[model samples]
Target: MSVLEIKDLHVSVETDQGTKQILRGVDLIINEGEIHAIMGPNGSGKSTLAYTIAGHPKYHVDSGSILLDGAEVLTMTVDERARAGLFLAMQYPVEIPGVTVTNFLRTAKTAIDGEAPAIRTWIKDVRESMVKLRMDKSFAERNVNEGFSGGEKKRNEILQLELLKPKFAVLDETDSGLDVDALKIVSEGVNRAKENTGLGLLLITHYTRILRYIKPDFVHVFVDGRIAEQGGPELADRLEDEGYDRFLTETPVG
Candidate 1:
């Protein structure tokens, strides 16, 4: 089943220079239980695409449609999109000074699930997920993303993914800024989440390093704010070997 669909989507941002178009008539469809990786160079609108799908308020869809599970999502509010089973893991997680991780997780759970899990059950689940992510139990009491290392933030996002178990997740460069050990641990957490919940994934990344750990069923090359090319897992290997030079040359600019 097609869980998410982007048809002739155009997105833009307002700036001093006026409207700057980011995504230009981009089209994509992600089915349930599929892993799709979108690879691109910097400023190719990879993150923009993810944020747009998740209904970020800053991004405006200039034209076209985004549908989640057959419903028009472009008209929905950000929280409404989340409640509709979409999740976005940002490239950079923001830190909230006063919100502890446990409190934040429970609040998000309450919002999404319409009721928070019992305190005891929630704590137990959080601890188990933390241990699976190779994190210490003390992390539960720490502020969300505050004073956390790059790897810690990434693992925390995966931890939320596990706890919430969204039907579809858009992971925007989750493997960036991590050491080998952290990468392995984050990859393990992601794999475990997918295995446990069969979550569909749209992974946005530039390097193929993470692909080695979390295999993708389909690979797409985003260039000039649109999907310039797409293929199976072999496409990622080709990009790894040949680089994105051809895509840059072939991609059409609107």
Candidate 2:
């Protein structure tokens, strides 16, 4: 089974005020077919952890290690990480102006698999995934995320997740701007990916609404750049009702 291990990860970012620490020391293990939710308030280092795992240049890993299976992920480039079966769905997916969604997906699949998928089957798979996402057929001809709505972009991210079949996915606030219908559809797509491929998810979000649909096996409460608490799905429900105020109040001051 595929596994991702983050051991005492301390990450920082360079800002005008000088280097600022974000993630203090995070340790988490995700196994195949497990959904782990990292819920926290804004600036609580939720997004930083996601981007750090994806090897975003803006965030620097000050110490510790990120290992996928047995290989050290910190040593891999972003694309190399993806090829290594790691996928990250960004909160704000960028637009590729000239590349059509079809071309982009096809190219990515080819790169990841080290060979192009059979053309007929590939087209069929993409069409089915889009239809399930409620995307119009014309979206395949459009530029990647260009002129797309927030919900559309999020759905496209899941489309990639479904088609790419990554071993692990770090979905960062995928439910942020989606309406109920869109949110449910996107959630279903994520569920499908997990069910079909045994995908291990590190779902990051502030609210529990997404949890109602995705149903994480573990809920981790991130506070002041560290995981202050952890539990099962009940923790998410508690956070939904109680909010993060209690954790915020007792955060260790530096």
Best by TM-score: 2
Please estimate how well model 1 matches the true structure, expressed as its whole-model Cα lDDT.
Answer: 0.91
TM-score, cand. 1 vs. native: 0.96
Report backbone clashes per prediction: 0, 0
The 0-to-1 C-alpha lDDT of every candidate, in the order given, reads 0.91, 0.95
Listed in order, each prediction's TM-score against the native is 0.96, 0.98
| True-structure Cα RMSD, model 1 | 1.5
Per-residue accuracy of model 1 over 204-239 as CA lDDT, tens digit each: 999999999999999989999998988999999999
Off by over 4 Å in 2: 251-254
Q: Tens-digit lDDT track for model 2 on 178-217?
A: 9999999999999999999999999999889999999999
Q: Residue 65: error of model 2 in Å?
A: 0.5
